[model samples]
Target: MWARRTWTDGDHGYLAELYDRITAPTITTHEPILRKAPDLSDAWWDSLSTALDAIAAVANNRVAVRQEYLDRAMPHYLGIPIDTTVPAWTAAHGDLHWANLTAPVLTVLDWEGWGSAPAGYDAALLHSCSLLVPDTAAQIRHRFAHILGTPAGRFAELVVITELLQTTTRGDNLELEAPLRARLRFLTER
Candidate 1:
């Protein structure tokens, strides 16, 4: 980012940011959806993991995923009694999906909602978005197993699934409803 300018217009506020140009195309053209998996190299995965780790290490006061939202959405979406307690929290990209990620060199875009969330929330969100591509979903699971296999990561996945399921009710992400529910069952049952 080069510069940031903020202004208030009566009751609202606006902010404009300047950033260096990204030449690489995003992994997916659609927002929050991944129809196909790109053949990414190990280096790309490593870079992404490192970037996420760096983001998680940052200190921020903003809340992207709230406790109140989790408390209400967990059991309702999972259809079972769930412990919504997140074991760990960290800074996150908040909206980490294929469309927000560039290929060849791994550039994460869209920081409008970046803030604190459950640990591994970014990976969970990315996995959820990749459900349409089973291979990609499995790759995410394998790559981030340390995070996605833990209690905190499982809860974070549940949180993301809940959010996606909620979106389905509004006629969005209709294609993801079945897989999202299946993943919910897997998470809740285990």
Candidate 2:
């Protein structure tokens, strides 16, 4: 799932090492949870909250995201705030999840979405997916806080907002109607 960017064998090796460094600890600590519970948990919610907070902090000081195609499809959708004002950069998987990662070997397979993104984007994505399992979601959240060194409360509001946005966007797809509706209900009820 790597993108069109060509990589030499050396680059691959470096990436592999980086992946191991980033994911090994979490994987080692959480593989059991992944294998057992795939649904979202209270813990996952907490982790998502923390990640969103970090994103919002960074996003608040940056320029707003702008994309013509996304705007066309979601005319009312406001783009996320991204801090382009900073000169720092970090490599991101763009999309990180259990499916793209392997245990024991600690390999991260998919790389299509890899690029420079805000801090904690990968963690945010992982937390988002972890919501599919309640217990694991909790574990993921706990791990996220440990990794990012942020308080979980910092992210709650923004995570809810982002999840709402994602739910609304997915509502257009018939296959996703039920889950999206449930998420919408959850958002509204809260």
Candidate 3:
């Protein structure tokens, strides 16, 4: 970010940060959701995974996704008393979707929600957003299998699914409702 500013008017206050322009285009279309697999190189994939790993290593107190939210949301959305306790916690991008990523060269955009979350929360979020594109979703799962295959990983995925499903009630990501439910059922049955 090049500049940041804050201003207040009466009881209202606003904050903004200006960033340098990025030349690389986002991996997917304008929407944050991925509808198809992008034709990015293996190196790009490696870079993305590495970047996520690095981000997770950072220490922070900010809470992007809360345990209370997870505990409340899981049973409501999955109709099961699923455990919401994360095996591990780490920093995450919080909104790691296709549109927030750039191809050719990896560049992560949007840090507004960066904070601590479940260990594999970022990977789970990226995978969840890629569900409409099976190939991409599979690639995400494969790339992050080390994280996504563990109990912590599964719980992270559950958290992502629950959040998405809850948003559907407000008419957001409505197209993902069925897929999210399907994933939810599969996870619960495991």
Candidate 4:
């Protein structure tokens, strides 16, 4: 179930969205722990991949993977020039993280940013967020190997890594810095 409403009350304008009422709470895909995480089974990962492929199949002409934006961000964020060719575009969740997903039944929330993005973007974003959990990160890479194995997918992973590293410099997710930096170095190294 999805509903979006735009309203103006007095001088304030608001846009509110009602996603599905999930039975289970959001998965722990964010910084700072609160409680035990839900059991993420292989079947759940399969569902995620299936849903992602379906979503990517949808038609969208939007330029979500903005080359100008990526090129401009790379130098400032990762301090490296992105000389690789930009990959072809496909639909993506834009902000795919563990917190946006629900367990038991797969439900991806926060669709406001969904649009055309680089291939393997959602997978890379998920992998980027799972850096703290090495096992989960490895599972994601394995599940989406076909996409992540491609040249465009590697570039997408690098882009996500750069973004994650940039976020860490701001003092957020400090624990992930070491792992992210190591992965960045591994990718950038000849």
Candidate 5:
């Protein structure tokens, strides 16, 4: 079992970390990000929900996300005012993007950024990742409506979009730049 460890090289300084691998035959949420939507069963989503619940229940002393950080960083970085009022905070896979999640049998990967965040933050980020595929995005929305429809959920969505926009501006994920800009404008226009 890999109990998260950090390493620093004595040379040019870097640590290669390792994780106990999850099951095989799993396709990442974004490996072929723009590919046609995967055939998923309702059972898969149910398992995903259960896993997210379990992860949220885990206790960690580190504050991966701070209220003040969100209050300050988001607006200044995105040039969009935010609703600083946070309604709920729970353990979140902070970088909940397609590349980090696995399909068929759901298995969330990437733990480096996991931390307490706005409730439904994971769902919002995942949904945003699916924007390239409308049907998949809609399905995600339907499944997580209870969370995504709330004001706090919308705030989480904004954070997700802001991050995508910032990444785009950095010349990364250039394919998403246009769509992410539109999404950011749509969310902030109200």
Candidate 6:
């Protein structure tokens, strides 16, 4: 479903809207709470390193989250460089995974957490989810790199942080919590 939707800018925007609706609390309400609690994973860390490299390569700039602010610190902790002063926005499907998409026929499900967000957010999400399977993750990253005309280094880091942000804000779902934590720690550690 995403393959087809990727072709239409309108569908992409709509998907972004849906993702925002579902995951609104994380960005708007719960981020502060999660920052204080330290819970994270090894797999998430591995993925975060890759993600950070990818973003750095694509943006061609050093990315760091703001200091003394949890919300800002979190993204930087996960290797996504965000400048509070700069306006760098793009439509994002806050949650984009195979479970949220239908195969055979293209239909993207789960449109609750959509919104305008950092660049490469969707690609990062897709790559992070693919991490569950090594081959799958490699393929996804490769495809993303090809599509974006860049390497998939920091992409996973961005996605992991994004996931952490969501899990922290919204009530913890057992399935997502573990992975999100893992990713969070992975990115935050020096």
Error of 3 at 77 (Å): 1.6
Lowest summed lDDT across 10 adjacent residues in model 2 is found at 151-160
* Candidate 2, position 9, lDDT: 84
Q: What range of 10 consecutive residues in model 5 has the weakest lDDT sum?
A: 26-35
Better of 1 and 5 by TM-score: 1
Model 2 regions more than 4 Å off: 1-89, 146-190
Cα deviation in Å at residue 106, candidate 1? 1.0
Name the runs in model 5 displaced over 4 angstroms: 1-19, 29-34
Writing each residue's lDDT as its tens digit, candidate 5 over 1-190 gives 6554555666555444666767744445435244457677898888877877776777776555678867876886578666776788888877766666666777777777788888788888888877788798888889888778888778888777766777766777677666666767876777
Off by over 4 Å in 3: 6-12
- What is the number of backbone collisions in each predicted candidate, taken in the order shown? 0, 16, 0, 0, 1, 31
Q: Write the per-residue lDDT of candidate 3 for residues 1-190, one digit (tens) a residue.
A: 4988999999999887878778999887677788876898999989988999999999998988998987888889877886778889999999998889987899999889999999999999999998899898898889899999999899899989988988899999999989888888888787
RMSD of each: 2.1, 9.8, 1.8, 3.0, 3.0, 12.9
Candidates' C-alpha lDDT: 0.92, 0.43, 0.89, 0.78, 0.73, 0.44
The lDDT, on a scale of 0 to 1, for candidate 4 is 0.78
- State in Å the error of residue 140, model 3: 0.7
Cα lDDT of candidate 3 equals: 0.89
Task: Decide which is better by lDDT, 2 or 6.
Answer: 6
Query: Per-residue CA lDDT of candidate 4, range 78-120, in tens?
Result: 7677674567678988888878888877889877788887788
Error of 3 at 25 (Å): 1.1
- Rank ordering of all candidates by lDDT, starting from the highest: 1, 3, 4, 5, 6, 2
Residue-wise C-alpha lDDT for candidate 2, range 78-114, written one tens digit per residue? 2434222312333455556566654443455555446
